[model samples]
Target: MRRAIDWAFRDRRTGAITVAQWPNLPLWLFAGTSLADWILNPPGTVAWALRLIAGASLAWWAIDELLRGVNPWRRFLGAAALAGQALVLATAGP
Candidate 1:
C-alpha cells in the first residue's frame, strides 16, 4: 500500500510524451475534491478556500507538465481552468 501510494506521487517517465499517461493521481484527487466542493456548495469562505487550493494545484500541475514536457494539452487546460477559477473566486461576493 505504501509502495502504491508512493507510486501515485512519483513520475519516472522519460521520453516522448504519450497520450497514454494520466496526470498525477493524488493531485487529481485533490483537484477533484476542490472542484466537487465548488459544485456542491455556496460560494463562501470554504468554497473560496477550496477554489484557491484548486487553482494552486492546477497551476502546479501545469508547471510540472511544462517542466516534464509531457502533456501540453493538460498544461493549457489546467492553466485556463486555474485562471477562470481565480478570476471568479476573486470577483465573487463575500
Candidate 2:
C-alpha cells in the first residue's frame, strides 16, 4: 500500500510529490472565457459563444491532463473535472 501510494504521487525525476502545476494554455483559455462570460454578461449569441469556448477549452485541458499528467492524483483530478463538466452540461436545460 505504501509503495503504491508513493508510486502514484512521486515525480520520477525530482522525487517530489507533484499533484498539480501552474495552469497551461487550455486552462488559461478556459479561465479567460469563463471570466468574460461572467463579467461581460453579453447578449444571447455572445454569451453562448463564450460558454462554448470555455467548455471546449476546459475539455481540452481535461483531456490533456488525463493523458499526460505527471502523477495519478493529477490524472484523477482531470477525470473528476471532466465528469463534473459533463454533468453540468447534461443537466443544463435548453
Candidate 3:
C-alpha cells in the first residue's frame, strides 16, 4: 500500500511526496481572468472575452499537467479538472 502510494505521489525530480504545487503560468492567468470576470463584471462582450480567456487558460494548464506532470497524482488531478470542465461546458446554457 505504501509503495503504491509513493509510486503515485512521489515527485520524480525531487524524490519527495508531492500532492500540491504552486500555481503555474496558465493557472495564474486563469485566476486573474476569473477574478476580473467576477469582480469587475464588465459589459457583455468584455465579460465573454474574459470568460473565454479564463477557460482557455485553465484548459491549457490541465493539458500540460496531464501530459507532463511530475507524478501520477498530479496527472490524475489534471485529468479530473479537464473532465469537470468538459462536463460544465456540455451542460452550460447557450
Candidate 4:
C-alpha cells in the first residue's frame, strides 16, 4: 500500500512529494461553476445543452492532461475555452 501511494504521488527522479498526478484545479473550478449554474437556474434547453457540452469538453481536457501529459499549450487553450464559456453564459444571462 505504501509503495503504491509513493509511486502515485512522489516524483521518481527527485524523490519529492508532488501533486502532479492531480488534474488542473482551475479547469475543475470553471466546470463546477458552469454545472452549478445549469442546475440551479436552468437555462433554455439549447443554452443548457451547450453549457453541458462545454463543461464535458473541459473535463475531457483535464482527464487528457492527467492521462497523457501536461503542456503549456493545453493550459492556454483550456483557459481560453473557460473564458469563452464564461462570456457566453454572462451575455446570455439566465
Candidate achieving the largest lDDT: 3
Error of 1 at 40 (Å): 2.3
Predicted model with the maximum TM-score? 3
User: Which regions of candidate 4 deviate over 4 angstroms?
Assistant: 12-14, 19-29, 32-40, 69-94
Worst 10 residues of 3 by lDDT: 80-89
Model 1 TM-score relative to the real fold: 0.51
Candidate 4 on 21-74: residue-level lDDT in tens?
A: 454654566566676676776658856665666566675664554444334444
Task: Evaluate model 2: give its TM-score.
Answer: 0.86
Which digits, one per residue and each the tens of the lDDT, describe model 2 over residues 9-83? Answer: 887668888867899999999999999989999999999999999998998888888887888878887898899
Pitting candidate 2 against candidate 3, the one with the higher TM-score is 3
- lDDT by residue (42-93, candidate 3, tens digit) is 9999999999999889999999999999999999989988998898799989
* Candidate 1: tens digits of C-alpha lDDT, residues 1-94: 8565434343345534344456585369566867688579856777767766676676676556555533555444556655765687689796
TM-score of each: 0.51, 0.86, 0.91, 0.38
Off by over 4 Å in 1: 1-17, 25-30, 71-94
Global local distance difference test of model 2: 0.88
On the 0 to 100 scale, the lDDT of residue 83 in model 3 is 94
Ranking by TM-score: 3, 2, 1, 4
In candidate 3, position 53 carries an lDDT of 93
Which ranges in model 2 have alpha carbons more than 4 Å from their true place? 1-5
